[model samples]
Target: MMIGLHSAPFLAMVAFVVATLVRGMAIRRATGDRPWAFASAKGVQRIAGSSFALCVAALLVAAALAPANGTNLAVLAAIVSLAGAAIVIVAQMQMGRAWRVGVREGDAPLFVSHGLFRFSRNPIFVGMMLVGLSAAIVSDTWWSWSALVLFVLSCIVQVRIEEAHLEASFGDAYRAFCRQVPRWLGLARSA
Candidate 1:
């Protein structure tokens, strides 16, 4: 059966929204803080999160509804998504205390540079990108691809904002870490 966007995309969209909202809320509740700062440079984090959710949804829709002919693209996307998820989970686990949805100015309960963090500065984002890409590939639609692009853009902007906040909070420590680690990508030694 040839699945199309009409049916699958909507379901994916719903799932994405629910997942993000639930996750965001959990993060908020766990951290006891909001993720957004109203006075700051707008709501980049919110926007980015929203964009990522939408893109992921679209990709999921495509994957489910589209026929599985075992295309190379779909296979690759699946691998990427699975790998990314694993990496992100490891990173999240390592960053137990420091894992908050929004920025925190004070000293983080923990400064994790272990596990996946030792490899990639932003393993979560990398995982997210892989998931987003997988969705696009699974969907095999222009819209899915577009979502991938938007997701990347959102991550880029959000990362910069996050970096500024982290630098302010961590000062030289963060600067030194940045010097050692790449922003989105990871080096071989750590991986």
Candidate 2:
């Protein structure tokens, strides 16, 4: 069996995860607030968010352990993975101090509508989904593909939960934004 542990693509995935965690920590420190608030999520929201995290871990493990296909498609997948990482970083930076891993209750952060937000309501989620998809594509393992499917489902549920919270917090403003921007990346529908 070929080992992907020493592969450049695997290392890049690891680096992306580490960089994201570091940025999350920095955002928490700078804001002096708990940005990793998934613990506060209850019911389905918590389950969905937790599932997304678990799927991400599964993808990481699969990426490290599974042999890459070494096909042109794999190379394309690697490029997509890098682009996803870039998207995550850019979206997080655009969010700045308001960047959060989970919903922070009792406090409504800024209604961000600039940069990537202009195109997608949840660019970070889009980026993460891309990463998961790329991981499955490159790994070419049954379990990795299954994990990607699960990740997408969980991500969708989690996004819906967050949207509900935003709507409740921001009311008409959030609704208006939703009207102007699609949930995923695309040109805005007639609004």
Candidate 3:
């Protein structure tokens, strides 16, 4: 039986741990009127955002501990996801202390149109999705796919909620940024 720390499942688990640590650091460094992110998300955003955590846990357990079915492609995907997460960290750093987990109601800190934000209106979400997708790929299991679906669903719901908040907060300036930047990537194609 192939079972050990050197297995593919272990790689997935390690990736999850590293990504979570990095993400946690980013969240820890966040600043703003964070009266909700730690307390609660607020309405539908609450449920969607909460699912994100559950999905992560599910991915870690199912993907990281599943039978070592991961292939070279899975390893490559894992590398890509880790790299994406690192980029997301850099992007978050660009946001400085203005980052928060969920949409903060009544808090309009900055529109942040520079750095990676210039590439995508929500680069953080894109990176996060990549990370989740990597987890799913490495896991090579139905549970991991389920987690990915949930992650995507959660991301979609949260993005909508956040856009509404941004539109209300930054008004026309944010609208302009949205027009200039794509929702995900490929800024040139987007334009």
Model 1: colliding residue pairs: 3-65
Best lDDT goes to which candidate? 2
Which pairs of residues have clashing backbones in candidate 2? none
lDDT value, residue 87 of candidate 2: 82
CA deviation > 4 Å runs, candidate 1: 1-42, 104-110, 188-191
Residue range with the least summed lDDT across 10 consecutive positions in model 2: 3-12
Each candidate: RMSD = 4.8, 2.5, 3.7
Taking the tens digit of each residue's C-alpha lDDT, what string does model 1 give over 16-134? 44544565567678887553342233366667667655666666666566556566665566566666666656666666657655454563554566777766788877876776666
TM-score of each: 0.74, 0.90, 0.80
Local error of candidate 1 at 9, Å?
14
Scored by CA lDDT, what does every candidate get? 0.63, 0.79, 0.69
Runs in model 2 deviating more than 4 A are 1-9
Give the TM-score comparing model 2 with the true structure, all chains together.
0.90
Query: Could you give candidate 3's per-residue lDDT for residues 29-62 as a string of tens digits?
Result: 5532442363466679778978987886786676
Task: Give candidate 3 misplaced runs (Cα > 4 Å).
Answer: 1-38, 188-191
> Model 1 scores what on Cα lDDT?
0.63
User: Model 3: which residue pairs collide?
Assistant: none
